[model samples]
Target chain A: MEGPKIYGELFGLPITQTLVNTWIIMAMILVVCAILTKNMQKRPGKAQVIAETIVTVMDGLVGQTMGKDKMKFAPWMLALIMFLAFANTSGIYGLRSPTADLNCTVGLALMTFFMTQFYGLKSKGLGGFLKGFLEPMPFLLPINIIGEFANPVSLSFRLFGNMLGGGIIMALLYSALAGLYFFPVLIPVPFHFYFDIFSGLLQSFIFTMLSMVFISGAMD
Target chain B: MEGLDFIKACSAIGAGIAMIAGVGPGIGQGFAAGKGAEAVGRQPEAQSDIVRTMLLGAAVAETTGIYGLIVALILLFANPFY
Candidate 1:
């Protein structure tokens, strides 16, 4: 409904709810990882099983999306997906979802953009990477360059727009129901289910999937 | 006062107009879903893979609608004209 609240200023930079929410989400993720991975077991306990399942699923996803040889990217992709999932779902807890902020989404997208370019050059050498823009004809080089830059713009906007849109709709719905005669308890549940749960989860998955596609595309 | 009110009125209308972009994704996703169902019917064994691909494609197709939403929200909440 409105921009993230500015809490205070530090070193001439204003601290906003988005930044605070991001820090909290990051710390929560670290704590969860520590708890899940605390004990080592040959057979397995519940937490160990959960940790192994997450690792195996992410590794399989990276292999399926990128390639079997690119299994090295599994950790990075897993972190991206995990962070995104938390950021997007934070809305359900009354905290502003960090992905709803353009700055946060842009930062995430920039990481993907740089990784794509870095790995592209790393895998194909400078000459081949540069020559990629000239395919079909030299005249199409500018178009190709624009397309490369557009990836990050679209990626950031896609996540930001979806999360913000859902947040706005939820906010409007709650305010509308609050003005009604009866208690608006159960009325907003379906909306919460669709907007916060369904769309949030789907957008997070789509973001990570698109990132994987872009990085893999550059490499191959 | 009159000019500011006029701009706000126009932006409210423009926000409604921007949402016309939703029609494209609505139709595109419906077609995708229909085709996906047909594919599943033809090859029930690959239903999981087919549905997964369909959902991903539908999400991508929904981007234009999301773009339109961003434009409408900008006009409503972060209006440059304001």
Candidate 2:
């Protein structure tokens, strides 16, 4: 709010920098795919190697999290992770992470929650889906419904908090040490790693894995 | 005295709201943890992988909680709302 102005249009939505950045990431991914696939490299160039590595790493992660039966979800997980990892570290070069915004993070969380519900229903079927709501108690259905509604609240805030925290701290720290460079960078290095790299990647993985779990659990 | 007291009350309310953010991540991270345990039970050979993935997911799951803390801190130290 202090940084960017949010305006509502015919769509009746507040468009912020995070939304713009989401589009930027999507466009970049598409462009990268076109370029990478345009020159099919078997031996591998720098870009190709990096792409492969990212995919392979995420694929391995999905395999571990969701099992071989659900390996198809790997691509989705990889894309989300790569986007988040890049976006989180965007601040390293004087940019902000989209996850730094409540709307952006909440939007993603809602998407995950929706996917969780939809796929859970899809895999488990309608009857199974309804049945899942009654798990461990027929009397707890109302509470479970409330729990389902709360998924996005939790998911969105988790990401938003960490990114915003890191951002605010870095800003405060950097300003406090305007005259000096060493301590600001050195001291905050761990912070950037933990908040941006570690937390960013971890959150992405968690989001993807949970989505899968929700689907499986719903269907089961 | 009334004005100062009111400000203090508002800040306290904001802090409480911020802490409420922790609730969401708590449930989410717990879900991730349970899944990780289940995964390990199924495939002990993949225990390392399971742990790595679970820890990774749990860490992500923990972000929202951090966010709530940030908001609470902002309320305390950098309350734009005030």
What CAPRI grade goes to candidate 1? high
lDDT of 1 by residue, A123-151 (tens): 99999999988987999998999999999
Q: Interface RMSD value for candidate 1, one decimal?
A: 0.7
Task: Please name the candidate that would achieve the greatest TM-score relative to the true structure.
Answer: 1
Estimate how well candidate 1 is docked, as a DockQ score.
Answer: 0.85
lDDT of 2 at B40: 90
- TM-scores, each model vs. reference: 0.97, 0.74
* Local lDDT at B37 for model 1: 94
TM-score of chain A of each: 0.96, 0.81
